[model samples]
Target: MAALSLALTALLAGAPGAGADEPADAAARGPRLYVPDPNPDALRQVVDLVKAGQYRDAAGVAAMVATPQAVWFGDQTPAQVEKLTRDVVKDADRSDATPVFALYNIPGRDCSNYSAGGAANTAEYRAWIDAVARGIGSRDAMVVLEPDALALLPADCGQDDAEGTRTAARYVEVNYAVDTLEPLRGTRVYLDTGHPGWHAVSSIVPRLIKGGVGRASGFYTNASNYQTDDANSWYGKLISSCIAYVEGGGDAADCPSQSVPRAEAQAWLDAHVHVPPSRMAHFVTDSSRNGQGPWTPPAGKYTDPQDWCNPPDRGLGARPTLRTGDPLQDARLWIKTPGESDGLCLRGTEGPEDPERGYLDPKAGDWFPQQALELVRYANPPVL
Candidate 1:
């Protein structure tokens, strides 16, 4: 523990002090996770409410979004990215916190969906990644690399990579990133392993392997989705078990799945695999909008569920923390940056607005006021 503290101190060198009134013993507790300066739009809403004498409401929203969160780096120029990265690391160091960064610029990101747009080609992506790495330098940073890079491949989305060239390039891009970023001494890289609701343990294990999970720190689940912590943890364990099984010369097809009964699955692991916790890959889950678990659309309400996208009444999940007790679980993170929109979700309806909400939603990555308030109001653990 002392060694870890010292490493953290080294990483936070040149960082500013937390505050003049901070307790002297605070440093003994190690670094807190850095929350990037709040979004301007959210802050403006707070200001507007305060001006209108809506103190309680303003306070509630402030409390919900003011906590430590990630800084996303996507589609910016190399120089812009470098400056932003260094600035964040410097700020976190000053505040005695550890910074988390999300890298989302793959060649064919999101398969031209709502959040579509990436580098023009593989070579450009490599250069962009190189710039990010240089900006990070030797700082102690945690990176959630390229969300959906693996789960939504070009081939699977009916992209014109018929010869598998684009799909092949996607793998190469992720592998290159793992190779480049994993070597940094104080850096930990986690590949995206889509949410448990989308990919079965057996299915994603192979994709994770192909995308270089073996070389990465581990994988992350439920980014920008609303799956409960219990469900996400169970799903992660199954994936880790499957990976260990395959690495030990067992077939991935034989692994227990999330659909299996819990006791039955545990029984299979107990009877078949002897691998210990340390042998399995560690994972993190997005707890930002899962406080109430997943939303259940009125039965048969729509032709397609689209449950993961901007569902109504979802609350905030677990608070951001590094002290998750499970040995194989590293942390519970707000990887989705709550209050950001999941695109104008049509949910398979023939209209410009969401059928459930009866209104148009914000575009992807835009600040969402109504949804943001709902997250705070229904927050399972309570925002306060």
Candidate 2:
């Protein structure tokens, strides 16, 4: 089949009412975002921490350091989630904040891999999507439809779990999300477009297209992963250009000068690399743990350099928030949601797991109070 990335470019470019002259005020208001990664488990911890009066300790820190609004689901059940989503959307509308959504749970998602496991199958995935859509109500909210769901699919992870027909099932699931969510009165749903380091523009665009980007609001470039806002903007622009090109009738098969070869593509990408603040349109980013990027283990010890495997000394990225200055940019989002574990933590994941830290203690998605302390450390002190 044509590469998944190409399909993404085409699919994502075809959202309903795109390029439809949004009001200037909309830009001024920017996209409303729900952040710090939207997992139910992590959000619950945040609530617990907040209730304990550790506002500076957890989600309270997120609220203080990032955007005031936090997205919450009513419950995991379809009926409850549906009601909760609408209520949250209404709350966002009333409070003048954006309701961000993770919309997790796709069958075989994470393919029983790290952050491993989710919904039983496609039908269940669809139900969850429907509930999320219903929850959106008729208010303006920004939804990060699904994280890593499209970007880190079967092929990307080396798992033949969803190849061919199964992959097609994923496409169906994603398209369902786009069709169901984007139509919400004032909602703009952005599909996950992994980070700049993970997939080439040509490769990822098709994946977005196939996953039904054409029907959603737009495809977001970086979510939860760190690659600097500067990097995110340039990457988003390049990818956006590719999608726009395809939507205008460009063939997905054509390499477009950049993707002809890996070396050439890398060179082209390098020259174009920059995180200008201008490119954040329908795109959103995860500012949670990116205050510092992927933690790199000291070289030579671990055989491999996949810092994304979970590294030490890595602090939070830009604080998760729903505000940003760029008119074209949607919102500076906390897509990853701070305090959630990145993976089953390790003292750096290679070899024997560290006993003191255990298998999942230091994972990226965990709620680390020390990490929050680091975030506050780096930023200019509060004026008050």
Candidate 3:
């Protein structure tokens, strides 16, 4: 409560409004995030570890879950989603913390891959977004809208009609969500760009503009993927600057990308992107599993390595915070639930086991004890 009071004071000193444009320093120095109640499954894991005489590990798991992370909503009816959203926002309000919501129910989400599941079509999806907006009515909340929605479209997944109808609808769905949610008094919406490692600056900026980045607060990177803070932040800066440049009548094709040398990219920004930090699209990065950074499998290990799919020996990144001194950046968040399996990673082999790990990884979103312990043990800054 005392810390909460100090954070509120700091936010007051900055700008008024949650997710609204405040002074750069005030937003950077804003209050610590509202930590949600621990997941019941996570609590049970801690208890199980205690019974096993693994007190230190139990404490680590407990500490990890206690830290702030996103509250995800997906695959629910409009009524159910509204209530669920309301419940979370109210709970966070009691703690004087701004809740970060990951809205993941966009149509054709994950491209029918391991994590595939979403609304049936654009109409239903828009209704869901409206319900979410209602659920979050008048509460300060941040939305990392639809991970991979912009980065992986139906066209990219070969699910598009001949005219790319589904792909065009994908853009419509995302834009509807942004228009619906961003107008709420206290909601800030950030569209996804997959991760720094996946998309180049020029490629993703166009997707963002088409998907309604112009009307939204900003964008986020490295959701549910491991790219080091240095990498994620640099990638974020490039994309933000590139988007600003394109929005200012410059060509996205002319925008610098990660493929260019770092010195060259910085030089390009210096030459063209003249917008101040406040005018540019701000961003957040996922630090949930980047403490150990990304994993590198053996060379030519498999035809489809799926390196993003639960590669071993990863650890947690920095704790979630709003006071990240970088003005163009907003916060570093745990967008993915750490310790959850990415899915069964066969690594292109016809087997049930994850070849690299020598076991069948749990289904995506399932509690994974082995991975959970590994994360706590290897967590950067030490989980405990």
Candidate 4:
């Protein structure tokens, strides 16, 4: 645990910090993940804490914001997105860092859930992707394309038409993004699988392939959820192996589910799923807020216990980096900024106050000060 803390502290010191530098090889060329300006609200939190004479807490907030996290782009015009993307890549270039750009504007995104907003149709999405790609032309950047595009499809959440028209378009939009962005000289595009806990290996591999994981770098799991690093890694390995099997003409349905005991799953992979690391899909996992693992709501307390929502007591997970030990695991990223809320979590209740937390959680993407403190305090590998 102390070693892990040391590594996290190094990462906080700088991307690919001591003992975590990216290989010099061309395939893994990102020098370090870029650290952009901190979110304004986060900056405010630090200032407020200091003014209130909480110097130690203020430093903790400052430290948390200094770590690298992905910059999300969605709901922007083609002209706007292109400029924004160009500016970010240019900034990272100036800093000699490779920024991770998370694209989130897919049609019918998030199944109209809390983080609900997207392009109105496939054409707009395609255009937006093109602008982003153009902006990233020949620049060094990693693209976590469309967080829930493949994970929470329209059909999966019953938001599709009777003929699954919207769902079909969703696939087209995602495939278009993959096709458009993955071809860039410096961008590595990853598809989505929501998280390890949400989709079975069998269920998500097919979705990944259909969404064009084969053409891109690989897929990402646990985008904004609190699944542990071990669980996410195991899930990624299984998913990547399944994709390889299917690419080699094996059925995805034959892949082992995460529920299968680990020993058995490894045996299954050894016996059947064989593709060299370079030949197979490689994955990244979100370690933004998995430190304390997941929040376990008081059992049977709320009817709709939205466990994924802003559950208190969660902590920041592993620091973002380009070097993960596993060859097939490309990166462990802070895909979700640690101190932000996941929306007003009603948790199946009547009043505005969340019964679970006894307070109204901030709206999605808002800076959550209380949760921020909890994240730093309970952080398994402490954020401070």
Task: Highest lDDT: give the candidate number.
Answer: 3
TM-score of each: 0.91, 0.72, 0.92, 0.92
Candidate 4 C-alpha lDDT tens digits along 1-384 = 454345434434543321133465745655678877777887678766756767666666667778778989998999999999999999989978888988989888788888898898888888998999989989988899888888778888888879989988888888888888888899899988988778899999888888888899988989999999999999999999998898899998899989999999999999997789999999999988999888788888899999999988888787777778899998888899888889988988895987878988888889999988888777667654
Top-TM-score candidate index:
4
Alpha-carbon lDDT, every model: 0.82, 0.58, 0.85, 0.84
RMSD of 2: 11.7
Q: Could you list the CA RMSD of all candidates, in the order they appear?
A: 7.2, 11.7, 6.5, 5.3
Evaluate model 1: give its TM-score: 0.91
Give the candidates in order of lDDT, highest first.
3, 4, 1, 2
Count of residue pairs whose backbone atoms collide, per candidate: 6, 54, 0, 2
Q: What is the lDDT of residue 303 in candidate 3?
A: 87
- Residue 242 CA displacement from its true place in model 2, Å: 0.4
lDDT of 1 by residue, 1-384 (tens): 454344333323322212211234765545577878767788667666666666655666676666666789898988889889988888888876778798999977888888888899999999988888998888888899999999988888888455899989999999999999989877889988898788888888998999999898899999998888999999999988888889899988999989999999999988877888887888988888999988888898788868888999988777776767788888788888888899988988886998878899999999988898888788877765
Any runs in candidate 4 off by more than 4 Å, and if so which?
A: 1-30
- What tens digits encode model 2's per-residue C-alpha lDDT throughout 297-358? 66565454455544444454444344455444565665555444456534334535642334
